[model samples]
Target: MRNVSSPYLLEQLMSRLVAPDAPRLYTNGQPWRDARGRGAPRHAVETEFKAEHAVVDLSTQPPKPLVVKCLVRELRIRFYAVSTIKNYRSAWVCFLRWYRGPLDQIDQEDIREYLELLVAGGASASEVSVTLSALRTGLDKFCLLRCTVGLVSPRKSKQLPVVMSKKEVQRMMEAARTLRDKLLLTVLYATGLRVAEVARLQWSDFDFDRQQIRVQLGKGKKDRYVMLADDLLPLMRQLWRHTKGVGYLFPSEGRRVDRHLSPRTIQRAVKQARILSGIGKAVTPHSFRHSFATHLIESGTDIRFIQKLLGHTNLETTSLYTKVARMKATAVASPLDRLRDEPGSSSESSGRQPKPRPSVGRMRLEVDPNPDSNGAYAVTLGVWKDGQLLPLPGMRATMPRQDWVSLQIPLQDIWEPTLRCLPTAQRERLESPEFFSQLQREVAKRILRIRDAEPFQALKT
Candidate 1:
């Protein structure tokens, strides 16, 4: 094989061979290198820019003049949290790289293409929606354009949240191998705090006298108060004393002792405890929040109160706990129980069998005009018991036509329950082989008599 020297010839050959939708190749090969030499690869440059400017660490704030400085400035002016600013900036950088065009020149089609690529790359619906939001913020505020990017996001799935049983929570707590792990899990379940809220806690947030803990900059950048569990107070005090009332309730062990612990650290600890406890559930730090809400609902607390405790803006959100709560539904009596007389009733203790009331009824053996191809008749049993005249319970049986002669045997067997209240000796005698033979003969004779009846003969025709 001869090596190709001309970049333009190699580019033409590669374009003809590679599918248009195939992932762009990255290599030092002549074709790819030649393409790159035409201009800097926008995605590679943008990725490097994002790495330098996107501050993902909660503890460390990035320097000024961020990649999307205008967006950051606007978000800050509107009082957006540091986290939201980082996300929007990251999204804008991603869009810039994917579009590979000047920001002012990009239009709605470019936006749709970027979103489609995100969906194709397996980004979740919420993630795509958030990215769209970031792009809108930039275009509307910075670019001064009001174009509608007509991309419909994937429908959100209505998945039930994962919750842990009380016993499972206890097992996870017990499985914690260290004091920090135990305290972390306890705080999460006790307060239903988001992992980020817990990671941001400081000693000043606790109020011993009021028995409350303040959570600042929650999901919506709103502050809320959660009841401090009395049981957890001692542990909190011990942790505080051990750490000498440090900057954060849980401080990072690294040299940056002034900053709080990262939420990822606590998440990893919770996962380890869940695995050690042998729980097969898909447990995450947020599962503790779900368990907190569900346990409160189970304990008879009002849903409104639970909503406040969990900082849910909507009652519908809190009401989802009702479905999973260990509530009155668990103690409800099944309808099947109504069929039996209650224990300690006069009839149960009387020791006398209730007299069988005389009733008039008829049993019809229905034969399907066209028997199943297998030559089997579908048989159904409808009975009106002595006390109740309604046909509430029905039974079905299938048998081959050749076995019809033995059908009376199973029918008589089905009626054995009517003699259950009789003395055991009497019942045993009724079920005896000799008694069964006589009963079978009587049933067979009755069935033959019915078969010869005018109505049955007419139906057979």
Candidate 2:
């Protein structure tokens, strides 16, 4: 080495000696001499001239380490919310590891790549959406600019709601093992209140004297009055006695002492009751709402009235139950049956005598598992035959109406479910003139449909 007085060249050489494995940079091949005329060693010259450099070691103090705590504290002092602070700190920490450099060196591209990796790793739509929101919020607050965040739109799938008949609903309520569970399902059906609304109900919502239930802020932030069924009044009185002290109408364990049971807890109870009832339908807390709508439609209540009671914003939403409630056309006595039975009618006059009277087929009036105080009665009109009573393949029978003509059957062999066991008045009204006329009209309609279908199905050659 040539002895020179260049202190800068001597400093560069000394700096290289600190990390012998580090590649050389700016090797101006000349040695510099010290003030005393003796060449200073590389290590001694570097130590004397170069600024302090801290070496990083887990066991020892770091040399010139970036203070992450200082950066985070400064961010917090800037009035960042707790959640924002957490999100920003997390993103920053990730950035440090990703680039392995000081915070100042990380760029927008680094953030983009990290997010892309997150998506590539198969994140769910909701999860990815949340993470994107967090990252965007963090960048805007701390980085002072909106970064390139991916667009993730949430999509909703269409699903038809579940409904239950009034009969099926009764079965489910009866299956309920506890008083609390029974009333829970009853309120759900009666008021058409959502599980959440029912859970949040207060004892004051029920006005016993007026026989009305006040549903406060029901679905869609609407309030409505639901009539209390007369049959349920006794049950309600008993329930009130036991639940008098509780702040919530349906209080349960783990809920706040002042608050009611959770919507999910009520839903679970309904699910269990449905399973035990052995009625094969997906009966949920909302099933009561469906049954309420269906039963109201079946009872000849106006759809508009039902819509208001249900708190439905649109009438169309309430109209779906109309299709589910079987509308019975006027019953018709089959001309064939009437003809064969009439003593001098042509059916008997033709070739052979009338065949042996076959067994009367099953009755159609379905029993309501949970009937109201009023007797359960809903009329149905379907085809009937005389020779051997052949039942409708797909349909079940509706309640026998006052207009239906009942031939007096000998009490020896058969017991009719439709006919109330009554003496003079009840027996006389079973087959009225109005009932026979209604039957004739319905039979004419069926005959017209049969005629129209025959022509339509016939192929034109």
- Give per-model TM-scores: 0.56, 0.42
Encode model 2's per-residue lDDT on 350-380: one tens digit a residue. 6676555333223342222332354332223
lDDT of 1 by residue, 1-461 (tens): 86888997787678679888765555444334444566666655431222223222212333223536756777788887787788898897777666544444567888787888988999998998888888777665444454445556568887888999899999888766456778999999999999999998998898889999999878876788999999997887767656887578999868898888899999888987776677899999999999999989888889999888888888998888898876475588676655356777665677678666332343233433333575433344333444543321122323333113233235454556654444565456555765544333333334433433545568699
Clashes of 2: 4
Model 2 lDDT at residue 70: 44
The residue pairs in collision within model 1 are: none
Work out how many backbone clashes candidate 1 has: 0
The per-model lDDT (C-alpha) reads: 0.69, 0.59
**C-alpha lDDT of residue 414 in model 1:** 55
* Model 1, position 86: C-alpha lDDT score: 89
Specify the highest-lDDT model's number.
1
Any residue pairs clashing in model 2, and if so which?
54-63, 331-439, 332-439, 364-397
- Candidate 1: list runs displaced more than 4 Å: 1-67, 149-153, 329-461
